[model samples]
Target: MTTNMTTKTLYLLCSAAPPVFDVAHVVEDAQARGWDVCLGLTPTAAHWLSGSLDGLAALTGHAVRWQYKLPGEPDVWPPADALLFAPATFNSVNAWALGLTDRFVVGVAAEAIGKGTPVVAMPCTNSAIAAHPQFDQSLAVLRTAGVELLYGESGFTPGPAGLDTPPHFPWQLALDAVDRHPTAQA
Candidate 1:
């Protein structure tokens, strides 16, 4: 299949969260807006989608990347005009803010911020996890680095327990954050 060079490239980073399974919503939404979507998954997220890799690859028209490519292998995806990570977990958020590049998802997020790429991380966690002092510090660090985080009202908020699914995942808010980013306007 031929890729349209003119289409805006969006890297949708998927981490382990309940909404991870519903990624098709975000992917389809980005596609509807004329974005050429590239998916980067955390190892756990990759496992979650393990059974459906083919369908997801066909959906994005690109490989589902979960690991760093070897030095000799050419990158299949283009430089991202925007990066959006949804269902970002507590560990992933803190790791990214702390400059930990051990995982593919956090690595890309940290490097993207350094490259001045527009990035948005919508974390999915309960209040129990949000109450962690380190989490607040992590969010501050990420915000200081120009990483737009979707939280609070109109964004992602910690939901109560006893529910099989999170009440909402704020996928559109992440998309909106990307849309509002000055560099992403292209």
Candidate 2:
């Protein structure tokens, strides 16, 4: 049932944000930190990285899963000890909070809450979307449901809407948060 029993499994779920472009580095970092990393992407993210999908799968030594498996089909990746949802877009965050499973990554994240899987999410969005009242409400819902959300000053700080250079995403912060989670410690 486990991929590498000695190594903790981390389901690195990513949405289609600019940060997603640098995910290969993040995977390497996670591997160096002793995690058995399994990369999962949102549909659009999968499309964005279509050309490099093979390389990513080879990097993680696991299938890059973006779509749900058919009924009666076996799961591809190992069960997660913890999950890190990084560069989560506004839509992904809200969808996850509301239990919308249309996207594979969001579905897994939403289900992880009830499965008692430790989850750390760092949402990537512009200041314009961050200002939405619904986004705040969605954040509250996720927090109340025991999801470790990294937003505002704690993690990803959204810059102005049209900044030529968006604020650098703090991948290390999210990784550190995952390390601090109970499941990861176990």
Candidate 3:
């Protein structure tokens, strides 16, 4: 039987890094699939990925959010169907892993997880950081909490035995993951 599923909303949380190229493509793809996409960018990330937000907004038909709050206004939180953190920087990953939510992206992610929103994180970093013991522990914690970690290219590189590899990005993998999630259709 085929299921008629509609994407309600998707939150794209980004961090500052060159890997952000992957994120822009993913956001565009998500919008193409009829998902409402909102971008929550870290302060540093905003500077790097500034121009891309206009393109994202054009494609998604929604404004991207960077600061925690609008100028002189209270917080306005957007409801999201799924949260995808692409090119998740090492800093943000560590912060979220240890329950720190100082930044808007990490804070929103924490809130989403607390409310049972499905989360897909595409962590992009060097091999050394990816293989760090602390990073592994953080991944374990997130996994235990039901967060799906889409470890980036580093995870797929052939190396040690018994290592699992993640599929590539472009929001297709994220959409597939969401399709498998019980809440995505709801």
Candidate 4:
């Protein structure tokens, strides 16, 4: 169990979906295992969360990115080791899979994927959207692009599941996936 894994840099992209609490739990767990976590919240998501960016920064010790604003001048772009999009809204998922980078999360994901960085997307949207033909196609595209889509315990949970805080299992599972991958080693 004494592997020399380099410190992981995790970029968490949050959407307005209700499952964001689950995403928070994942971030906290990732931090516990020495991963540096940075959060990028969609404007809609920030409005829905009802918390200040400062609060998030204090909690994670990293600045919260609310827009696609680059880190320059007053900001510094953090080098990401990996990217995770938990509770990804159907809209965001489709946009990301289809190469639409109008949003910060999608933009970052595109960049990371281009750089061969590991990407895991945990999409949480309505069942209808998840079942839509377009959604299926989008997932196929992401898979072909080397993005690991975790369809949750099943094939993606839909609708608001009341954010029953994800038990530590998901975080452990994510880390384990990273460890098992040869490229994840420093």
Candidate 5:
């Protein structure tokens, strides 16, 4: 499949959130919007989508990555023109803010801050998780680092705990954020 040279690359990262099950549709939406979408997942998220990995790769025309490349190994995905990490879980959000490099999705978002890559994140969490003080702190840290956070009323609002599914992940908001980002316009 041929890609337009002018198409911007979007690193669409997902964490172990319930909405992650719908990631394939999200990728297709991004593609329709003219993005060269590369999918990345947290370890658990990757495991959740294990059966669909190959189909996802075929759909995106790129490898679906959930781990860091080995030393001296060439990067499989192209450099991200912008990143949209939706359905980001509370743990992933905090880990990324704290500069924890343990999880591949969070690690890349963390490093992206320092690299000045435009990033937008929509965290999926319950009211219980959002109540944690550290969760707010992490959101602040990410905002300070220039990561556009889609949370609260503008993004994913936490519902009561123990739901089988989260409020619909605000993927469109993340995509809109990316479209509005200065780097994306350039």
Candidate 6:
């Protein structure tokens, strides 16, 4: 199905991770579900998708934003009804929970929560990183603030540390969770 600009807007804030390269799949899937998707990447994720920026822009019909725009820069993207933080790194999660908004993705995610936007996050950290005390605390903080975190049983779990395979990044689950959020329907 072709999603037009009039559909509900979703700001997909992608962080750097192995799954960052597969963001096109999420965009297409979201579009198929009738969302007008806008992508906001962390600096690193933007670099990772640098070669495909034009393609991404064409697909979303909007520029993929990473850095903060100048004060007078005309905003081209539609207002977002929801924000999905996919491939969220451990750093981004922790930073966001602590109210750090230095990076565009983290900053936007933080602001979205404060604005009561329907927000969903899919963290892509390994068990080792997830085991950090701060990681658990961050998850707790976000969950307390009504952020839908796609982690543990409801989301992706880390694979064996030494395995050659990366844990499957559940891009679709993030969208599903967002759709299920009360704010989205409100």
Q: Report, for every candidate in turn, its global Cα lDDT versus the true structure.
A: 0.85, 0.89, 0.70, 0.69, 0.88, 0.85
What TM-score does candidate 2 reach? 0.95
How much does candidate 6 score in TM-score?
A: 0.92
Error of 1 at 20 (Å): 1.0
Alpha-carbon RMSD, each predicted model: 1.6, 2.2, 5.8, 4.4, 1.3, 1.9
lDDT of 1 by residue, 36-89 (tens): 888999999999899977888888899989999988999899899999988888
Clashing pairs for predicted structure model 5, backbone only: none
Identify the superior model by lDDT, candidate 1 or candidate 4: 1
Best by lDDT: 2
**Candidate 2 weakest lDDT stretch, 10 residues:** 1-10
lDDT of 3 by residue, 11-111 (tens): 88888856565665666566566566777888888887777768766655666677677588954435888888866777888899899988989989888
Candidate 4 vs candidate 5: which has greater TM-score?
5
- Relative to the true structure, candidate 3 reaches a TM of 0.79
Residue pairs with backbone overlap in model 3: none
Report the candidate with higher TM-score, 1 versus 2.
Answer: 2
Best-to-worst order by TM-score is 5, 2, 1, 6, 4, 3
lDDT per residue (tens digit) for residues 40-90 in model 4: 877788776656566667666676776766556554446877777766777
lDDT of 6 by residue, 109-170 (tens): 89888888988898888888788899999999999998888888999887756644465877
lDDT of 5 by residue, 1-186 (tens): 216754688999999888999888888887777789899999999999999999999988999999998999998988899999988898999999888888888888888888899999998999997999999999999999998888988888899989979757777778888989877764
TM-score of each: 0.94, 0.95, 0.79, 0.80, 0.96, 0.92
Q: Residue 132 of model 5: what lDDT?
A: 98
Q: How close to the true structure is residue 107 of candidate 2, measured as C-alpha lDDT?
A: 91
Most TM-score-accurate candidate: 5
